[model samples]
Target: MADSNDSQPGAPVPCAACRGTGQVISNLGGSPSQVPCPWCEGSGTQIPGHDAQAARRAAAA
Candidate 1:
């Protein structure tokens, strides 16, 4: 069966920072090395067409 996420006709692209893994390395000098990326909110993806800047502006508005 097709994956539900893949089945979406217009699913957002995988997040560049997290590369769709939904987590990034935290350089805060503590344990719990991985943290959810603020960009994709752990979803690990941005809107299909909008770049990161656009997405941020959109969110601000």
Candidate 2:
């Protein structure tokens, strides 16, 4: 296994549901079709410690 420092931690590598391509592939022969990454939600970057209360005041609000 690789170290956390070597690579970003808690970051969504790729939306398994949508794949790293960030699109809902369908009808292979279709002209064009694509969507955002469901896992990362198209952000491509996952915020660390999202579960934690980084902003408790906002959360409480």
Candidate 3:
């Protein structure tokens, strides 16, 4: 059998911070909230936090 959790092409991976839940606790509402992703700039993708090279590549895309 194939190992589970293997990445399928075109499928969005889970968020590491929200544990794929897509929402975090909010102080004002006392409810969940969608936090801007630090990696992909809230695009929900793992983006490099390196130099301007990574940022430029992302912008170009």
- The per-candidate count of clashes, in order, stands at 0, 1, 0
Worst 10 residues of 2 by lDDT: 47-56
Candidate 1 — which residues are off by over 4 angstroms? Answer: 1-10, 30-32, 47-61
lDDT of 3 at 19: 57
Q: Judge candidate 1 against the unseen true structure and give its global Cα lDDT, from 0 to 1.
A: 0.72
Task: Give the total clashing residue pairs for model 1.
Answer: 0
Q: Model 3 over residues 1-61: C-alpha lDDT tens digits?
A: 8687787776676656555554444454686666554344455444334243565477669
Candidate No. with top TM-score: 1
Q: Model 2: per-residue lDDT, tens digit, 1-61?
A: 7665666655456445555555564354676656554345565544344432434345468
Candidate 1, residues 1-61: lDDT per residue as tens digits? 8566555666567888889888888777666588777678788886454455665577679
Question: How well does each candidate superpose onto the true structure, as a TM-score?
Answer: 0.53, 0.31, 0.30
Q: State each model's C-alpha RMSD to the native.
A: 6.1, 10.0, 7.9
lDDT of each: 0.72, 0.50, 0.54
Better candidate by lDDT, 1 or 2: 1
Put the candidates in lDDT order, highest first.
Answer: 1, 3, 2
Instruction: State the local distance difference test value for candidate 3.
Output: 0.54
